[model samples]
Structures are given as structure tokens and as C-alpha cells.
Target: MNRTNLCIRMLQLLKARGKMNTTQLADALEVNPRNIREFKKELVLAGYNVEEVKGRYGGYILNDQYDLPVTIFSDEEKDALVQSYKFMRTQKDFKPLTLYCDAMDKIIATSKISSNASLHYMSNSIELDKKISSMIDKTQQAMNHGICVVLSYQSLKDETPIEFEVEPYEIIHYHKSYYLIGFSLLRKDYRMYRFSSERMFKCDISTRHFIHDNHFHLSNYIGEHSLIPLDLKHVIVRVYHKENGLRLFKEKYWGNKLLPIHKEDDYTDFEFYTDDMSNLYQSLFSMMDQVKLLSPDDVRETYLNRVEKIINAYKG
Candidate 1:
């Protein structure tokens, strides 16, 4: 290892093992015992808290409070990190956007000397409106501080905005949109609100502080295949162009409960247990003639009706 890497490894060893004598550190780092003192000086000069112990069991110890910034990265790891940053950049209204960019800039600056690889990434994430972005920021701040917020929200069913107090718990991203999960003071229960800039007229952070409910867990409300708390259904579909359909499902619904129940030479019968039927319908519609809803008679009827409406519209 180079001198720079050796110094870093020594600090890491000290941090992990608590304390290490010169000989022990040298053995661990595969360096000479004499170089240990030099490495300690280098770390101290770089603002790391490396302390020396004088007793028989003593050696060098990194202060427990101070954490060393991880600067080491392989070429592949650096490329992957850069690509992640690029992808995040595509989400123009991502909360904590500035913090992520600043952190990535620091990492890139440190890794520039080791590798100079260029990478590109593309994403189709929706760009959030400015008002919605501001609301998300406010909600995040409230969640961090354990505070209440007054939200003027208007759901699709509500003709006018309904002002209510909420104990903000968590904000989650799903399907290129943001949702707030919190305790609604009006309903006196947990609720999930999909953010809409046009409908959400006000999101004012209140002065009242709140203690987070210890019994409340996100998993209790949201299932593995759900965007919000809802009952999941067993759905089966027959998809033509087996190769293409399989690839699409694997790419889009990799984590969901998807399995192949049957297959033919040209088509495949895929089963999915999902709570997000809207997303499912949208994805199936995108596949056009290559997909068919086979089971759950009501859902199949709904899909057929939607297809018929589209067909009729086209005929007009």
C-alpha cells in the first residue's frame, strides 16, 4: 500500500480495535513498526484525534467522539457513487437536494486523484412543482423536530380546502411522487396524504411540539407492495411476447410479489399480489396488446372498460 493508504489504514485499525501498539498496528497494516509514529503524526496533522497511551497495554487510540470521513474508494465504487449522484440530480425537486449534492461534491473531490472515470445516467422521475417542493421541505423539518403542522389540504373528494393539524411522522417517495404519513388531529388517526401543489394551499409549521408515537410503525400501515395503507389482492395476468413481458415486469416490479404460475411457447401467466391497482393498470395499459388481465373478475372488467373507452375514443 502507498503511504497515504497506509496512514488511513492505521487510523481505521485504531478506530476499530480501540487501541493498538506499534508492532500490532504494523502487523495489521503490513508496514514497519518504525513507520507507525510517522503515520500517527500525519493523522494528527490532518485533524484526526489520535492519542498515545503510555502503559504496557497502551498504544494509539482514536477518540471515540470524532469520526474520520471515509475517503477511500476503488475505481468501480467511485464510478457507482458518481452515477448515483447523477441519478439524484435528475430528480430536480428531491428533498435534501442541497445536502446530497454537497456531500457528493466532497466525495468526488477526494476521489478525483485516484480515478478519472466519466459516467452517465438517465432517469424519468417527475419534476415536482415549486410549491410542492416547499411543502416537502417544511414537512421534513417538522418531522426532524417532532413538531405539529397545519396543512390546508384538498383531496379529490373535497371541493374546498380542509385545514387540519397533523403530527408529522414520515415522508416517503413512491412512483415519482411524495406522500406524507402522519397522525391527523381532525380524524384522530394515522393518514397518508399524497402531495398536490394545486390542492395543498398551505403547509404551515406550527409551534406546538409532539412526541412521536412509540407504537406507530410505518410497516403496520404500508405493505411491501403498497403505496398507501390498503388491502392487497391476488392478481393474475397472461402476457404475450414472453421475453419482452418478463423483462419489463422484472425491471418495473422486481421487489413485489410476482411469480410465474404457468407458461406457454408465446405467453406467460404471471401472478402478482399487489395493493396498488392504479399503478398496475397504468403499467399494463402501457404494454398495449401484449398484456391481458386474466383473473379477479371485477378488476378484469374494469380493465376491459378502460380499454373499451380508449377504443371508442379512437373511433371518434
Candidate 2:
């Protein structure tokens, strides 16, 4: 069979069933196993990554997202864009979070979401998984049809093969990640699940109608730590030593919002803040010694108290 027919048939098969390995695909395509290998090379040549799974549960997965370049700008251009966005989000007076989202939507509407968005934010950390290409396509179709969808989520709260019958509402692509915002049947509340790290996905339409009178906006339902809420302004952090805690600070942030104030007495100060104390603490604790809260007594006290507990816990 021609590769075109083969791909079409395979797409249908995958839509019906979540995933299929090399052997299954080769057999279904009615070609020699060796030909299957050649076909995959051809697919890659045509801009697709035929992913190979290793170990017991490993199999051949089609990565359609990587099939082609979907953006007008090059890699450097996109990185600069993300950096600028990070600054806008974390700035002291970044108003109209929705505008940011809207602007991003417009900027990325026609472009490829894969290359532009960074699903994993872990800097230099060996932690990331390439999301299945078919999953997002199926999700888009499901969302368009207003059907129930399933998710295999492992983040923040739910961490299992969650069979969620959800009414798909919106697709949020922020912080170099894509999320599906919807109403969950199990929780009976709104939740946003990341498209990445999704082990598997399947969707079906239900005859039942969703109660959509008092719609809880996605912007409000998001966590406080997010730049959307925009409560706390900015803070000025003064470092003691010039090269002190620099690594920790950079590792914590992407070097967008935290700007250098000055270097003093072998110490330097950077300015950045957020309403989410936990995020703030994470950013601060990474700067083991050189980091200090120059202003905002409350934030300083919280850090000191945590330090006290640590000290008491490890008393000599």
C-alpha cells in the first residue's frame, strides 16, 4: 500500500485505540517488518518522528507534531519571545492577564504549538517526556465536539489513569506549556490538565448536558502563584556577596523578571517578587546564603521562621 493510505489508516486505528507498536503497525499496514523500518524513515524524511519505545511496555509511537516547522520565527527568535513574555508576566504591574493569554493565542494560533511552547520548564534537569502527537489532535476534535475526555495525569493533585468524563472548554498554552481547561465529572469542578506527561488519552461524546449557567472563569480558578491573579507587586532583593547565590537564582528563574540592582561589598542585589510565598521561598532558598529580602518584613520573617525550624531540627 502507498504511504499515504498507510498513514491515513494508521491514524484511524490510533484514534480508535490509544497506541500501537511497530509490529502491530507493520502487520496492520500489510508490509514486511523491514519495509516498516523503511516506511518510518520515509515518515521522518517527510517531517515526522516515529518514536520507539524500549523495555517491556515500549513500542513505535508516531510523533506527528515534529513533522514540520509551524512557526514564522527561528529558534533564537522564539526564545527571545518567551523571555520577553516571562518578563511581562512577572513584572510589578502586569495588568490584564487575559490580554497576555489572548496575545499569545494570536501569536501562536497559526504557528506550530510544539516548537514554540516548552512543556517541561526544568532547566538542565533530566526530566521531560515527548507528548503523543495523536493525543492533542484527538483532544482538539473532542473539544470541538463538546465530548467527554479521559486523561492519565501525574501532576500537583491527580496522579493516576484518571478516567475523566470532562466537558472540554478551552486550550491554554502558557509558560511554554499547553493545558486543557475543562469541567471534570469526577471532581465536579474546573481543572486544567497539562497536555504533556499524559500517559494516554481517549474521548467519547455523552448525551448528558453540562450545567454552564454560572461559569467559573479559567483565569480565576487558577492558583495564586500564577501570574494571572497579579496580587503582589515586585520586591527588591539585596545580595551580600558579588558572586553569591547566583547559580541558585538563575536556576530558579529564567533571568527575565529578576534584574540586577548593583554589586556591593562582594555582594549583589536582584529585584523580583510574587504573591505566592511558596514560589518566592523556592526562588529565595535556592540562593542559599547570598539571597536576602531587602524589603517586605513579612516575607523576611517567613523565611527566618522556616530557617529557625531547620536550625532547631538540626541542633548540635
Best by lDDT: 1
lDDT of 1 at 214: 34
lDDT of 1 at 6: 94
TM per candidate? 0.55, 0.41
Worst 10 residues of 1 by lDDT: 114-123
Sequence-dependent TM-score of model 1 = 0.55
Screening candidate 2 with a backbone cut-off below 3 angstroms (N, C-alpha, C), the clashing residue pairs are 47-67, 118-176, 240-267, 241-266, 241-267, 242-266, 242-267
Candidate 1 residue spans exceeding 4 A from truth: 1-126, 241-257, 312-316
RMSD (Å) per prediction: 16.4, 16.5
Residue 145 of model 1: what lDDT?
69
lDDT comparing candidate 2 with the true structure = 0.57
Error of 1 at 54 (Å): 56
